[model samples]
Target: MNAQSPKTVDDTRLDSVIYQDGIMRISYTLTKTSKDEIDSDAFTKDKKALAASVSCDEKGLGQFVKSGLLIKYTINDSSSAPITDFQIGKSDCL
Candidate 1:
């Protein structure tokens, strides 16, 4: 796995969507894997990055945690137009 950050991070490479409830849903496909890596940790980090991508108040973010979803992946400017900062946590759908 190339542990280096790409020069140009493509939003398409990192697609995230914010629902009406303010929970940001993010997904990614890992290009590399390690035997020691845990799936849950990877997912959590990605979710945090997604949360960082948005611009929301800590209080607003609290709602996500209260709701059980935790932000994992956060990439600022994940899209063409600047979108609102989002939070990620546990989701029943997932």
Candidate 2:
């Protein structure tokens, strides 16, 4: 008999509508194979970098840069609370 390891997959979801501040937030739930959790400072830094890389020019109205980002990760299946939640953005995004 042969045994195979289970594949790990992470799911990410985005809200249908973007916030008024021109920020789009995405959420991801942690799984058993995922890391314990990340600190606020690290989370903030990473999310900001991610937001900067994303393009917000959906309407073709010039090049719109990503001003901010918010990321939240939930730990464990029992708890509804998030393990880490972070948001970063620019003041003059619009």
TM-score against native, each model = 0.27, 0.37
List ranges where model 1 is wrong by over 4 Å.
1-12, 34-94
What C-alpha lDDT values do all the predictions have?
0.42, 0.40
* Model 2 weakest lDDT span, ten residues long: 71-80
Estimate the TM-score for candidate 1: 0.27
Runs of candidate 2 with Cα error greater than 4 angstroms are: 1-9, 19-36, 56-62, 66-94
Identify the leading candidate in terms of lDDT. 1
Model 2 per-residue lDDT tens digits across residues 1-94: 0122222355332222234555544444444323345564686467555554443344531143332443222222213345555443343234
Q: Write the per-residue lDDT of candidate 1 for residues 7-49, one digit (tens) a residue.
A: 3343234444434454445434332333234354565566556
* Top-TM-score structure, candidate number: 2
Model 2's TM-score against the true structure: 0.37
Error of 2 at 39 (Å): 1.8
